[model samples]
Target: MVDNRYTITVGTEQFRFTRDQLESDPGNYFATYFFGEFTEASQGARELVIEKDIQLFRLIQAHLRGYDIFPLPDAAVPPYMTKEVAIKNLRHDAQFYCLGKLEGTIKDLEQTSVKKEVKNGGKSPLARRYKAGECVISSYLQTWTFQEINNDGYQLMLDKLKNIDIAIPSRRPQVPGFSVTFCWVKENYYYALLVSDD
Candidate 1:
């Protein structure tokens, strides 16, 4: 806890830490860039003011302090909420800051989150775990095609499946994140076993 300190204000939120605290992490993007010769001002009031989401930055702070952001469960995470989205966003920020170690941790957490969500019916590209050789059945997903996630229209995937000559099974609305899904036809039915390109 050095006496020399500063505050990094991101949007409406402010975080205070010492130069020593940041330096202890060494390779963190904020630590490397701020204490180095390339630091720039995000705002001009004698503080590092950045225009970014405050909620996610708090998690970044947690990572810098050698801790995982807590009080947030991994299950039932959504894109709109911080707890569910923190690590992913933090990873993005980490990449920007060139925080290599933190990014590795975030990547690991992402893989774990994806695995846990698989049993709980979560559909994220990061969490859609599968391989090319494995034969997936309808238990994983129904045999249907989706297109343009933001504006999900049945395009090529649906069109290709339509031409295969089988019961054109009714499809539920596709989730809004993934762009492409890998599928296979087996046992006279189509199954969306693989999701999103690897």
Candidate 2:
């Protein structure tokens, strides 16, 4: 007989979460994946295999368990990864899971993280602009500008728009409303622009 349990495997890790625990949040992806009509046949099976990052999934699980995903203790994060990267990955996982609340928390953490980076002297030029409530956008061929939450968001966007170069002033601009532009020299031309508020 099939046991009354739900199992999820991400990478080399496996996690067990109850139906209620997964469904506690309305519109949660896990809830529907395990209980929705598509899952009727597997309701008895109650097992899911996700080809995603295990460490990131663990953080998502921690959030489900009511642990703060930000400012993660040194011991909680893997030795090779930085908390900033973890927070960034967590945002993606949260989005994939359709965990609205988790996404909200991630945004709050992003803002806080940017502030902390500035204080700790680990911030990029674009970071300060983001902290100032200014919007930044990246683009290729000068057609459309892609806007993200900043800091980690900027990095993620850049990764997606690979073969690009980022250029920001090393010294803080003394003037207000200064903008930074990131361009790249690839086989095909590409560019990303970040405009700050006045």
Candidate 3:
């Protein structure tokens, strides 16, 4: 079943709607239109402040794009009080696994990390290699593998890289901080990794 129950807040007013209600009369346009206007108006703001605040816009867009927002079962009110805030939180949540991959590499599967098992496992040698700072290129002929991971979030990024028709090369940036850039397969977004040495 499609888990609905999304929290939408307009100004100070917040409402939770199930999938049936969202799909029934309101159609999601109300939420989308409001956020669209909000972002459009903010485009002219100073870049520094805008950069910090654009997350609000992203949160709304993610919902309109049909991403599911699951509230943590134990939370009080839901981490997000507004639609924009929810999207930002979802994006952050989606990133957790991807960030875990990078963090796993950074910690080197030391004695005290949760992902030490995945790191040491022989199954994903490529991930292990990439974690160890080795550069590698891989390609996949089938698109199904890519589609299968649509909901896996950014960790699916690696699978998408694998599915590219042309060679997708990945490299660890020489500098410490977490930025690795590879060739462009789609557009301006480069296949990259953010790694930190601990």
Candidate 4:
């Protein structure tokens, strides 16, 4: 029961989208393939078979539909979908499809979700929720796992920080110490890092 359209078969699933829709964002992989050309005359053109993950393909469609894959915070997730699962899926999809524009959207959504968590009361269950670029005062330090500085060289310490659960910030987290790189300073307190050693 499929209406005629640009049918892309991915795994066992098939999706249909108009040429206009597929060409909407020429910057995207699929759009680029069909744009500025006689797509109808392209070799073996009737159907495109995708060998990658189908879950991610859905994310691409969602983005084309609304610029972002997420529904409103209060909206019910569609059948077979949830916000967390969708975000995770779309990230892989964006990478596979070379949909680079979606990277910023994903980061923005993650930051926004965490901020909402903080504002609603504070302290999400996992310290891993702390994103790369965020800073916090000593009062909320419990949400993060701070590491102790040892005699190890700065590069070694920096490497260790990478293994920590700190969510990679949009710009990457820096120890930024004199020897330690550095992060932020407040009052008389100074800390080069905000992630737990756990």
- Which parts of model 1 have CA positions greater than 4 angstroms off? 1-3, 39-46, 70-79, 82-85, 113-198
lDDT of 4 by residue, 7-84 (tens): 778889988777777765556667655543546436536566788556666667766655555653424333345446
lDDT score for candidate 1 against the true structure: 0.55
Q: Estimate each model's TM-score.
A: 0.49, 0.54, 0.21, 0.47
Q: What C-alpha lDDT does candidate 4 achieve relative to the native structure?
A: 0.55
Query: How far in Å is the alpha carbon of 37 misplaced in model 4?
Result: 8.6
Candidate 1, residue 135: lDDT: 26
Q: lDDT of all the models against the reference?
A: 0.55, 0.62, 0.35, 0.55
Best by TM-score: 2
Ranking by TM-score: 2, 1, 4, 3
Task: Tally clashing residue pairs in candidate 4.
Answer: 9
Worst 10 residues of 2 by lDDT: 131-140
Cα RMSDs of all predictions? 12.0, 9.6, 16.7, 13.8
Candidate 3, residues 55-151, lDDT tens digits: the string is 3434333344445323322232232243323433444543442333223323443333436545665333223222213223345321211111111
- The model with the greatest lDDT is 2
| Structural RMSD, model 4 | 13.8
Residue 138 alpha-carbon offset, candidate 4, angstroms:
45
Clashing pairs in 3: 59-87, 178-194, 178-195
